[model samples]
Target chain A: MMDFLTNDLLLLSDSAVRNAIPLLLACLAGLYSERAGIFDIGLEGKMLVAAFAAGAFSAIAGMPAYDGGWEMGAWSVWIGLGAAIIASTIFSMIHAFASITLRGNQLISGVAINFFAAGITVLIGQHWFRMGGQTPQLREGQRFEPISLPFAESLKDVPIVGDIYYQLISGHNIIVYFGFIIVALTWWVLYRTRFGLRMRAVGENPGAVDTAGISVVKLRYSALIITGILCGLAGAYLSLGTAAAGFGKDMTAGRGFIALAALIFAKWKPISAMGATLLFGMLEAIGNKYQTLDLGFVVLPGQFMQALPYILTVVILAGFVGKAIPPKAGGEPYVKER
Target chain B: MNKNLPKWVDLGLIPLLTLLLAFAVSGLVVLSIGQDPVEVVQVMIKGAFNPFGIGHTLYFTTSFIFTGLAVAVAFHARLFNIGGEGQAGIAGVGVALVMLSYDWPHWSIALLVGTLAALAFGAAWAAIPAYLQAKRGSHIVITTIMFNLIATAIIGYLVVGPMQGEGSQPQSERFPASASLPDFHEIFGWFGLEFAKHAPANISFFIALVAALLVWILIWKTRLGYEMRAFGHSEKAAVYAGISPLKITMIAMLISGALSGLMAVNTVQGEAERLLLGSVEGAGFIGIAVALMGRSHPVGVLLAAFLFGILTQGGAELQFELGIPAQMITVIQALIIMFTGSLENLVRMPMEKIFIRAGKGATS
Candidate 1:
C-alpha cells in the first residue's frame, strides 16, 4: 500500500494536474463570458479550432526542422500557440457580433458558433493537409517539451516533500505553469479591478450598469474577447501539451462543457473554478487508471469514470448537492431601452 | 422600426432571405476552397430534387420532423430541450428491447410496443433534467446538455456490455422480420409505381406528419399548452394567473421528450432495423436550428425540416459528385442558423424599416 501510494498515486496526481490545465483555462474562458452576461457553450468549438490551428500551423512552420537550443528549440510550438490564440479570438468575434450587436439569443448564437467551429476546422483541415481532417503528428522539435524546475533534480533525496515537488510540480509544459498565472490574473481582474466590478454588475443587472453610464455593449465585447483568448490558450495547451502530437476532429471532446460545469460548480469564481477543474481532472485521471488497476473481485469500465463528471454535474444542478446560481442577466441580451 | 408587415414576410420571406444570405456566404467559402460556387449550387439542386433524392430527403425529413417538433414544443414553454440527441439515441435501446424481446405476429403490434418503449425511455431520460429544472431551479439547458453526454455513455455501455448480439459486432442482432416497418416503395408499389431501392424513406414519414399535427393541436388548443406558453412569455404574469411554473416545465419537457423519442421509430425501426451508436446523428442539435428557422410553429417546423432534409441529401450528392467535403454541409447549416436565428435582426430590422416606408408611401 505504501509503495502504491508513493509511486502509483504520485504519478496519478501529476497526470491529473497536467490534465486539469485545459479545463482550468477553459473554465476561466467561460467565466469571462458568463460574468459579463453572455452564455458561451461555444468554448469547445473555439478550443477545437485553436487546436487545429496550433497543430496545423506548427507542423507547417517547423517542417524545415529545428536544432536543439533553448528549451529544445521548439519555436514552432510557441508560434502555433500564438496562431491558436489569434484564430480563436477572431472566431469569437462572431459570437460577440451576433449576441451583442444583433440583440440575438446568446444561447442560439453560441450553438451556431460551436457548429461553425466544428465544421470550419475540419473543412479547412481536410482541404489543407488532406489527412481526413487531422494534422500530421509533430516532430520532437515542434512539441512542447516538459520543463523540469531548477530544484527538481536536487530535491530527490528528501522523502515525501521531494516526491511531491519533483514528481508533481516540476515537469509540466510551460503552458501548465501559465495556467496558474491565468487563474490568478483572472481572479485579480474579476475581483480587484473596476472593470471586473462593472462586468459582474452587468451580469447581475445590466440595467443598473447602464444606469451607471457604462457602455454595456463595449464591456460585454471585451469579456467576449477575453473568453476567446483564454479558450485559445486552452486549445493551444491541448495540442501543444496534453495531446502534444496532432489534431483531430472533435478533439476538445466536450472539455468546454466540463469547464462550464466547473464554472457553475465553482459558483463562477476563478479560484474556486481552479479547484473544481482540478477535482474534475482528478476524477478523469482516476477513471483512466481504473481500466488498468488490478482488482480481483471488481471490474471497472472506462465509461463509468468518463460519465462521473457529467453525473456529478447533473446531481449538483438538481439541488441534490448544493445550491449554485448563475449571473442574473446571463442568457439575456441587454437592451439599452426596453 | 416597423411593428406591422404582412405576417407572411415574418414567417416566410424573412427565412428565405436569410437562407439566401447563408447560401451566399457558403458560396464564398466554396470559392475560397477553390470549388466553383455556381457548380455547387447546381449539384445541390439536381441532387436534392431527383426522385431518388426526394425519397432520401423525406427520409431525413422524417427524422428531422420528429426532432423539430420536439424542440418547437419545448420552445413554446420557453424551455430549450437540446437533449433530443441523447433522448433519440437511448430510445433506440428502448426500441430494440421491445422489438427483440417478443416476436409479435403482426407489424402493428410490434410498432405499438416499440413506440411505447421508445417514448417511455426517452421521457425517462428527459425526466431527470426536467425535474431538476422544475424543482431545483437548475438551468434546463445545462442539465439537458449533461444528460446528452451521459446518455451517450449509457448507450455505449448497454450496447457493448449487456445487449451485444451473438455476432462479433457491437450492434445487436436484427429484429425479427415482423417488426419491420413497411418501406415507402411497397406503399408506392400498391399504386404500381417504382421507387428508389437505395433510399430508405419509409412509412415513418406519414407518422412524422401525424406527430406534427398532434403537436400543433397540443400547442394551440390545449389548456396545458396555454399555461406553458403563458409561463414562457412571462413567469411573473404566469404566477399572477395561477399557473405553476414547475408543472409547466415538467409537462412541456415530457411532451418534448416523447416527440424526440418518436424519431427513433424512423431511424431504428424504419431505417436501420436495429439500434446503433450515434443513430441520432446530431438531429437533436439540428432540431434547435429547425425550431429557430420555423419560428417554433408546427407548420413552420415541417417546412424547415424539409428544407434541411434537402440540404442534407443534396450535400451527400455534392460529396459524391463534386468532391465537396461533408463538413461544408455543417458549415452551411451553421451559417443558416446564425443568420436566421441569432442574426435575425440584422435582416429583420432593416427589412422592417423598408416595409414601414413602403406602407407609408402606399397610404400617402
Candidate 2:
C-alpha cells in the first residue's frame, strides 16, 4: 500500500510540474505588464501567435539537408524560440501602441489583440501549411527534448527519496527548469532592482513615477516588452517542450485564462504565483488521470476538477478566501499634467 | 477642447473614417496572404447579398443584435460583462432542456417559454459574478472571463454525461417539431411574398428587433437607465445622488445576460433545433466589436450587426470560392474593433483639430 501511494505520488508530481511550466511563465508575464500599469488580456493571443511561429519555424528549420533523407543535426528548437519571441514582441507592441500611445481603452485593445492573433495565426497557418491550421509534425531536433539532471540515473536505486528525485525533480525539458529560474528571477527583478521599483510605482501611481523624473511611457513599454518575451517562452514550451509535436488550433485551450486566474489567486506576487499555478497544475494532472474522482461517498465529475482553478480564482477575487487588491493605477492611461 | 464640433461628426464621420482605416489595413492583410483585395471584396459582397445568401445574412444579424445589446447594456453600467459567450451557451442548455421536456402543441408557446428559460438561465449564470463585483469589489472583467470557462466545462459535462442523446455525438436530443420556430419562408408566405424555402431566417429576427427597441427605451427613457448611466459616468457622484452601486450592477448584468441569452432563440431553437456544443462560435466576442462600432446605441448596433452579418456570410463564400480561410473575417472584425474602440484617437485627434479651426474661422 505504501509503495502504491508513493508511485502514484511520483507519477502525479511529474505530470504536475510539466503542466505548470506554461502557466507559470504566462502568469509571470501578466505580472510584469499589469504591475507596470498596462492591463493585458492579450497574453493568450501573444502566446498563441508565438506557439504558431515556434511550430512553423522549427519545422522549416529542421527540414532534411539532403533530398529524401532525415537529419537531426539542426538546432531548430533554439531558432524556434527566437522566432516565437520576435513574433510575440511585435504583437505586444500593437497593444502598447493602442493602450499607451493612443490612450485607448486597455481592455478593448487587449480584446482586439486576442482576436487579431487568433485570426491571423490560423489564416497564415492554413495558407502556408494547408493542414487545417496546424503546422507540420516536428522532429526530435525541432523539439525541446527532455534532459536528465546530473546523477539522476545514479540516484534511481535508493528509496522513496531517490524515486522522487529521479522521477519528479529531474528529466524535464530545459524550459521547465527555466520556468523555475524565471520565478526567482522575477522576484529579484520586481523587488530587488531599481527598474522594478519604478515599474511597481508606475502601476500604483504613475504620476508619482513621472514626478520622480522617470519617463512613464518608456517604463511601461519596457515592461510590456518583458511581458512579450515571457509569453513567448510559455508559448514555445507548449509546442516544443510538451508531448504535443506541433502547434494545433486553439491549443492553448484557456490555459492563458487559467494563468490569469492564478495571477489573481496569487494576489500578483511572483512566489505565490508559482504556488498557485502548481496547485492548478496538480488539479489538471488529476483530471487527466481519472474521468471521475470517487471519494468513498460521492463521485465528482472531471469537469469540476478542470474548472477548479477558475472557481478558486472567483472565490479569491470575491474576497471569500482573501482580498485581492489590484494596483491603484492599473488600468488607467497616464497623462502628464503640465 | 473641440466640444463645439457637431454631434454628427462625433457620432458619424469619426466612426466612418475609423472603419475605412480598418478596411485599408485588412486589405493589406489580404495582400500579405497573396490574395487580391479587390476580388475578395467583390466576392464577399456578392456572396452576402445574393438571393440565397441574404437569408443567411439576416440569420446571423439576428444573433449579433442580441449579443450586441447584451454588451451595450452592461457598458451603460460601466461593467465589462465579457461573459456573454458563456451566458448564451448555458442558455442553449436551458433552451434545450425546456424544449425537450415536453411535446408542445404550438411554436408560439414553446418560443415564449424558451425565451423565459434562456433569460432565467443566462441571468442565473451571471448572478454570481455580478454579486461578486457588486458587494466584494471584485473585478467584473476577470470574473466574467472565468465564468465563460466554467460555463464551457459545465456544458461539456452535461452534453456528454447527463444530457447526452441516444447517439454518440456530444449534443442533446433534438427538440420536437412542434417546438420548431417558423422559418422566413413560412413567415413571408403568410404575407404572400416570395422568399427562399431553406433560409434559417425565422420569426426570431423580429424578436431580436423588438428586443432592440425595448433596449433603446430602457436605456434612453427609463429612470433606471438614467441612474445606470450616471453610475457609469461617475460612481462617486452617483452615490452622492443616492444611487446604489449594488442595485445598478446587479440589474445591468441580469439584463445584459438576458439579452445574450436571447441569441439561443436564433441558433438553438430556430436554426439547429438542437443544442450542439460550440454553437455560440465566438458570436459573444463579436458582440464586443459590434458594440464598439455601434457606439452602444440601438440604431448603431442594428447597423453594425448587419455589417457583421454580411462579413460572416461573405466569409463562408470566400472559403468556398477563393479558398480563403473563414478566419479572414475574424481578422477584419478585429481590425474594426481595434480602430473603432482602441485607436479612435488616431482619427479623432486630427479631426478635432480640423473641426476646431473650421469653427473658429466660421465664427470670425
lDDT of each: 0.87, 0.92
In model 1, the clashing pairs are none
lDDT of 1 by residue, B244-350 (tens): 88889989998899889988998898888887777888888888888888889999899999988988988999889987788888998899889988888888988
Write one digit per residue (lDDT tens) for candidate 1, span A1-338. 87887799999898889879999999999999999989988898899989989888877777754432223246888778888999899878988998889888778887888898898888888887888888878877677888999989999768888988999989888889999999899889988999999999999999999998899999999999999899999998888786548788889999998998888888899999989999989988988777633468877677777888888888777766777888999988888885
> What tens digits encode model 2's per-residue C-alpha lDDT throughout B186-259?
99999999888898899999999999999999999999999999999999999999999999999999999999
For DockQ, the strongest prediction is 2
Best-performing candidate as measured by TM-score:
2
lDDT of 1 at A169: 88
Note the DockQ of each predicted structure.
0.75, 0.84
**Interface DockQ of candidate 1:** 0.75
Instruction: For residue A268, give model 1's deviation from the true position in Å.
Output: 0.4
Q: What is the interface RMSD of each candidate, in Å?
A: 1.0, 0.8
Model 2 TM-score relative to the real fold: 0.98
